[model samples]
Target: MSLELDINAAIKAAMLGKKEAELRALRAIKAAILLAKTAEGGNGELTEADESKLLQKLAKQRKDSLEIFRQQNREDLAVKEEEELAIIEQFLPQQMSEAELRTALTGIIAEVGASSPADMGKVMGVATKQLAGKTDGKAISAMVKELLK
Candidate 1:
């Protein structure tokens, strides 16, 4: 996959630049890719969709860790996680802005005739499929609730 090439290039650049944060994130990504390739039942190669899903999973883990660090007042750990999160997120597709998400959700809501929260399931079934990779499910659901209300 082109992702492997881009990641290899990034790793070299980060090493040359001596960027600790970038180096750490890149190595994690590289390791994840390697593991994925070697995992049973997986092809030795990753598809574009598979790679994107992998990156998103890494980003989510970082975010969860970051939040816990913040809650426990672990600024040192939180800072490192934040840096990694930023680096990991760069590989994900650009996410929709709030206004854009709202507009898109509104259209979906109308399309599905979801005028009440009771109809959220109907809207979500379609919205999640259509908007996959564009935004987080939590963000989409929160916005949907607001719009429906």
Candidate 2:
């Protein structure tokens, strides 16, 4: 199923199951889709790629918020954000593990002829394009840096 269709179905299931956190995340996903559909320059609807990008962006925001909440010692808010993140993540592809990410990045680095940190940009450009929606950019970049050094 397409991400949008799956999200809608999940929303219905969440509502039926009385899963509050899942329901809230699904509603947010729906709202994001609506906004994307109506946004200026948007094609009046979201393509699957656009939907994936939107979902990834939402998931990234939740992860960032979870970090901030933890840093602020707001355990309640942190837990809430973590719950939302988990719900959001269910729609994303299974993430690449650290070892898997490193292996992939190594291949990308070799493919891009990146021999040192100076070539980090070249490696990152290719890696991000290839890995988008499969892995987080920050994690990929960090691994690339570590491998290149």
Candidate 3:
């Protein structure tokens, strides 16, 4: 199923199950889809790439909120953010392990012919395209930088 259709089904299932966090996440996903649709010059329907990007953004937002809440000693809020993150993550593809990511990055570095830190940009460009929806860009960038140096 398309990500949007899957999300709608999940929302229905969450409602029937009385899963509050999942319900909230479902609504957030719907809102993001609508926003993407209505954004100036945006296509009415999101491409798969667009949906993946949106989901990634949502995950990042939840993670950032969780960290901020923890920093402020708001355990309750942090817990809520963590719950939402879990729900959101259910829709994302399985993430790469650190070792897997390192292996992939090494291959990408070689493919891009990156020889030094000066070639970081070339390595990152190829890695991001290959690893999108599988790994976090920031993490990939850090790994590439470390390997290049």
Number of the top-ranking candidate, with TM-score as the measure: 2
Clashes of 1: 0
Residue-level lDDT tens digits of model 1 in 22-136: 9999999999999999999987999887788899889989999999999999999999999999899888888899999999998998898888899999999999888877888
Model 1 whole-model lDDT (C-alpha atoms): 0.91
Top model number, lDDT: 1
lDDT (10s digit) by residue, model 3, range 11-120: 99999999998899889988898899899998688888888889999999999999999999999999989988998898777889999999999998888899999999
- Each candidate: how many clashes? 0, 0, 0
Better candidate by lDDT, 2 or 3:
3
**Model 2 residue 109 distance off true place after TM-score fit, in angstroms:** 1.3
* Stretches of candidate 3 exceeding 4 Å from the true structure: none
> How does model 2 fare in lDDT?
0.88
Per-residue lDDT tens digits for candidate 2, residues 1-149, read: 67678888998899999999888888998899889989998788777778778889999999899999999999999888888889888887778999999899989988989999999999999999998888889999899889999
Model 2 ranges with Cα > 4 A deviation: none
Candidate 3 — which pairs collide? Answer: none
Residue 122, model 3: lDDT of: 92
Per-candidate Cα lDDT values, in order, are 0.91, 0.88, 0.90
